[model samples]
Each structure stands twice: as C-alpha cells, then as structure tokens.
Target: MSTQARPGWMEKPRPVTQVGKAIALVVVVALVCVPFLTILSTSLASQGEVVENGGWVLWPTEPTLDAYRDILNGGIVTHALGVSIGVTAVGTTLSLLCTVFLAYALARPNVYGSKPVLLLVLFTFLFPPGMIPSFLVVKELGLLDSYASLVLPVLVNVFNLVVLRGFFQGIPEELYEAARLDGAGDLRILWTIVLPLSKAALAVVGLFYAVAYWNSWFYASLYMESDHWPLQQVLRTYVVAGEGLTDTTTGEGTVSAPQTVQMAVLVIATVPILIVYPFLQKYFTKGVLTGAIKS
Candidate 1:
C-alpha cells in the first residue's frame, strides 16, 4: 500500500476562502460601526437639526455639547444617571461576592450536600419561579420599594455559578494535593491559587453581572417610585415614550427639553457599556471556552 502526500494547495489556504472570509469580516465590522456612528452623530447634532431631519440624525450640520451639558447639569436625567451608577456599582460588587462564594463551595467535590445544593440551583434555571411569583416574593420580603429589590433576587446567577464551578473543577487535582502537602486549607488554596488563575472567567462573569444590573429597568420601575427611576427607565419615558423632560434644575426653568437632549440621554446611558465592552471582550472566548470544555 502506497501512502500519497496531499497536494500543497489542498493543504494550504485557498484564495477563494481567504477572500470570502475577508469580505465577511468587512461586512460585520461595517455593520457594527454604522450604528455606533449613527448614534454618536445623532447625539452630537443640534436640536433644530435633529427635529428637522425626523427623529434620526445621520450627520450633524453643526455639533453642540449643549445636549450633554443640559442632562449632566443636575436635571431628572442626571439624577437617573446617578441612580443607575449607584445600583450598578453596589449590585455588581454584591453579586460577584455571592457568586464567587457559592460557586467555590459547589466546586468542591467533598463539600457536604454540594450535589443537592447544585441540584437546587439548577432546578431554578429549569423552572424559574416566574416573574409574578418572584415579584410577590420581593413584595413579601418588603423589598418592593428598596434598592435591595435589584440585587437580592438576582444575587447569584445559576449559569455564572456553573461556569465558575466548571472552571474551578478544571484546576488540576494535583494542585490541591500539593497545596495540602504545604499545609494549605481550602480557603488558602482557593485565595492563593485558584482565584488568581481564574481571572479570565471571573472577569467574564463579573462583566455579565455588571451589564445585566446596569441595563435593568423593569425591576427598578416595578419596585421603585418615579423619582427613584434609573437612567434606562428615564430613557424609556423620554426617548421611547416621547415624553420630554422639563429642565427644572436650571434657574431658567420650565423650558421644553429638546428631543436632541433625550437622544443624548440614551447615548449617555449606553456609553458606559460601550467603554467597558472592549476590555471585557478579550476575556470572553478564553473564559467561556475554559468553563465549557471543563463542563
């Protein structure tokens, strides 16, 4: 039997495949850039120009920072932005702490009732106790009119916990054994070894929680009063519902706020995610793939 070597061209990249991939990549990049450019242009355009050109502003005749200034000057929009930032920071920290502890415990093979606890966690994912039921629970717990409503119900996301667990499991058994040989307890091993090594997964999961908390408005609207509303709910009212805000904060009060300002509010709310996205994206593949492969 003769073993023949394959043709060089067959083994190498084809021009057609390379060109096709290049085209696809260009299309994807263009698609992503177009929306961001459009939004940014719309946000920068003058109120008169935006209104004259329908609700969308493709390009600015004259750009102005007045829209940003108006919102940032302690109006309802600014207050809502503050609320969003507060909730996002507090909620992300609390969520990461709870998820880390829970995931670490569940990752341990010898932990008592770990299997049952994990089963209970997984059960919630399958049969999520529905929105109304969860709402009632929140109400019953007297969290209906408080910030805890945002963080408590969603303290530890099951999927994130599972991902962390899988990542923790993939740490070599010998590492644990070696740590034990050096008189390290589980806490010491985890703090000194496991966590530092799992930075990618931690970043990915932390960003997921942060983004979720930042984007959340339904819960805030349901649990909070109008004055307590976050930026998204405010955006929903002003931008989506076409309700313009009054600039009461300024000494020149009762001015009809421009739609351009509303558009700028939407842009401001979205900008934090845009800024954080690039940093978080680098971890996604390695973080997700490691957990997935281990599981």
Candidate 2:
C-alpha cells in the first residue's frame, strides 16, 4: 500500500480547478457588482453627463448629488422613505415576537394541541390562501387604507416559525429541566435561557422579517392609497411605471434627467439592505445551518 505525502485536507487543488473556481467567482462577483456600480454611477452623474451618455453611464465624469437632493427634499420619495422605515421597524418587531412565542410553544413537548396547531400552520404552506381571498379578508377586517394592512396579513411567516421551533428543540432538554427546578415558568425560561442562547437564530429570523417588510410593495399598493405608499411602491411608480417627476423641475423650468432620478431611487431603496446585511451576515450560516440541521 502507498500513501500520498500530502495530508488529505492540505492537498493542493489542481491548477486548472483552482483557475476555474477563480474565474467562476469573478464572474459571479461581476454579475452582482456591475449593475450596482452602474446604477450608483448613473445616479450620481450630472444631468448633462447622463444625457451625453445616451441613457446609462458606466462612470460619471463629474458626479453630483443633485438627483438625491431633489428627491429627498420634501418630495414623494421623502414621504415614502418615512413610510418604509416605519412599516419595517414595526412589522419586524411584531412578527418576531409572535413567531418566537408560537415557536417556543410548539417546541415544547406535550404542549396542548401543539401537533394540531403545527399542522394548521403547515397546511397554510401547502395551501396558501388565494390573493383575492386574502384581500377580501383584509377588506372585511377594515384594514384597507391603514398601516395594519401592510403588517397584519403576513405577520408570522411559517418558515421562520419552523426555523425557530427547530432551533428551540435543539436546545438541551436538561436546560429546561434545570430551569424548571429553579421554578422558572415557560416565559422566564424563554427570556432568560432560551432567547439568550438562541441569539444567532433570532438575529437571522429578525433580518428575514425586516427585509421582507422593507422590500414589500404590492400589499401597500393594493391596500393603501397612493399618498400612503411606501418607498418601494413609490419606486415602482417612478421606475416601473415610467412616471416623470415633472413637479420637481428647477427654477429654470428644466427637470433633471429621469434616468438619474430613477437610479437614485433604486440606490436609496437598496442601501438600507446593504447596510443591514453586514451585521446579520455572520449569524446566517451559524443560525440557519443549525436550525436546518436540527430540523
């Protein structure tokens, strides 16, 4: 019998394989980055530069923040921004709290009706209510034209609930027994023991809820009036619908190029997610993997 000199773990990859991986990674990064860079550059470009480029600018010759200023200065974009932030913050908190409670209850052994309750939740995944039915329900509940319309309909994500329940179940049984011996109730155990240890899972789930709320537009458009629309809905109106910012014209009676303004709106809509992702990224693998494996 013969053995290679290199340890299996330390064995060098074939040069071709390494090169292929490098190329693939570069391609993936470029695919993600190029559009983002183009959008940012176009957004920062002066109106004259954008016009000279004939639509999109790979790089601005002389960048200006005028587009951003024009949009953010007491316009529809500003109002929509406030709406998005408010909805995301409030919706994430409510969803997380409800999900945590439900998951904890379902994770506990011998909890009354836990199996049936879980089945009902899983049934929703298999047979989600139709959009029309959901809309009618919301309308019947008088949530239309209200902020609750945005949050209530999708409050507890079943996948998030399952992830949290699995994570909770992965906690050692002895911990619960020990807490019981110390006279800790379920709420106390959850607060002092379970939640503290499950920070990674909670962070991942919280981020999921936050991002969903932030990116949501259709529900807002469906339920709320245009004046109450969120940033995403406003972005959809301007970018997707090709509506112009005629009201934002300068004193010289010239409006900035629609391309620059559209890109600026896109950048604004995307930036919060980018800023938030770094903080939650470290928890993603640890939390999601642990929950997935345990489940």
Candidate 3:
C-alpha cells in the first residue's frame, strides 16, 4: 500500500510533536529522579563531603555504607525497623484475610443483607469516622499503646474491599454451581478455585495493604508509645521534625552528618515500597482493569 493511502491511525505522529513528547517525558523523569538521586547520594556521602557540598550532594565523590551500618546497629532506627516489619507483616495478613472474606460474602448474589452491608461499608467512605471518635473507640477498646491499635482501626479499607468484591463477583457463576455439584463447600470453592484464579487481584490488593501498613506513621504516633514506634514514625521524628540523632543514637562512635543519617532513614523508609512495587506492578493494571470492567 502507498504511504499516502494508509489509514490515519497508522500514520506516525509529527516529528516535532514526537520531539515535544520526548522532551516532556524527559522533564517528568528528571523531576522524579533528581530528588531521589539527591537523597541516595546524600545518604551515601560522608559527613565531611556533605559539609563541603553545603548540605546536599547530587553525587557522592566516595560513597560509604557507614550511615546504613550506624543506623542498623542497635539504635532507635533499628528498633523502629523491627517494629515496622512486624506491623506490616501482621497488619497486611489480617487486613487481607478480613477484606477477602468480607468481599467474598458481599460478592455473593443471595447473601442476606449483602446490599445493606455493602451500602454501610460504602457509607464510611463518604463520611469517614472522625479521628477523635476513632481514637476514643480505640481507647474504650483498651488498644491505647498497643500494636493492635494500628491494625484494628484500619483493618479493611473500603476501596480494597470493593475491588476484591468486584473481582469475586466477576468470577463465572457456573464455577460455583460446579463446585456445589461436587459437594464442595464455600470455603473449599474459595481455596481450590476462586483464590487460584484470582491471584492477580489478590496480589494487587495484598500489595495495597502492605504499602498502607508500611507507610503508616500517624496511627503509630497516636496509639503506640515512643518505644513501639515504627520506622516511618521514627523517620518523622528525626528526619521530618528536625530532631537530631544525638538522642536516637546508642552513644556509639562518631556520628555521621545529620543530613546523611536523615536521608538514610528516608531511604530506608522508602526502599521497602520500591522493592515491593515492581513485583506486583505487572499485576496491578491487569487486576484492577479486569475487576472494574467485569464487575
């Protein structure tokens, strides 16, 4: 076919427009990457190097793991890391289980009060419970200064529940019928059939739960004592609140630059999400689109 006779859809974008898009993309990438680079570089930079560079280093002349080593060695950050890992692990598990069960129940066609229950859940999204009220409830429940305080209050995110429910509802009804004909119970069907097929949705939802638990700081600050604070809360204390590491350190050897330690904490707080995201990213779009579209 002649080039002129090709369909409009087949035609390439104008060269100038392509150039403009490339430039725009580069700008966006740089906007994101520059700060991250600076943080990483500054974290790796020695105290003297940071001082010489006037507080921020875009590139370290000689990178060192001293900051990381110092932070991880029996300090406030170390304890906070342990707390964050524990909370994220336990919270994500409980949240995923509760969300999945609730979503599955709601997704069923003839479940008693399903509509009312779903509506009630959705209503919370529209008018979320006030923080004070939530706190009071937690306190009344005797969760204050308890790790359970962080997880229990925010156990099932309405949006994640909706996504999971939609995905469950999208499963073909014939499968349920077939399982029932084979004398399979609801739990069996879920374990042997629904869960296996819904891996994408599960992965995506699980990632969401994990990220929420990982990034959570405010709840820990409110509900837990200082000793039980998570990594993000400790990050907030030292990095965001401009609290120096003097009090945080275990009175070890010479402390690194405050900026380096701060950036190291920032990097540590950020790294888990970055490490996790790529693995689940491939499923995120597919799962969300499939659930949303099919349901």
Q: In the order shown, what is each candidate's alpha-carbon RMSD?
A: 4.7, 3.6, 3.3
**Most lDDT-accurate candidate:** 2
Worst 10 residues of 3 by lDDT: 248-257
Instruction: List model 3 lDDT by residue over 1-295, tens digit each.
Output: 1346667778665788878888999999999999999999999999789988899999999999888987888888998999999999999999999999999999887678888998899899899879899989999999999999989999999888888888888889999999999999988998999999899999999998999999999999898988889999988877777765654454643344378888999999999988988899999897788656754
Residue-pair clashes per prediction, in order, are: 0, 0, 0
* Candidate 3 deviant stretches above 4 angstroms: 1-9, 246-257, 290-295
| Clashing pairs for predicted structure model 2, backbone only | none
- Residue 77, model 2: Cα distance from true site in angstroms: 0.3
lDDT of the candidates, in the order given: 0.84, 0.90, 0.88
For candidate 2, lDDT tens digit of each residue in 1-295? 1145767777576788878888999999999999999999999998788888897899899899999998888877898999999999999999999999999999998689999998999899899999999999999999999999999999999989989999999899999999999999999999999999999999999999999999999999899998899999988877878765545434332343378888999999999999999999999998888767765
Better of 1 and 2 by TM-score: 2
Score residue 101 of candidate 3 by CA lDDT. 91
| Superposition error at 68 for model 3 (Å) | 0.8
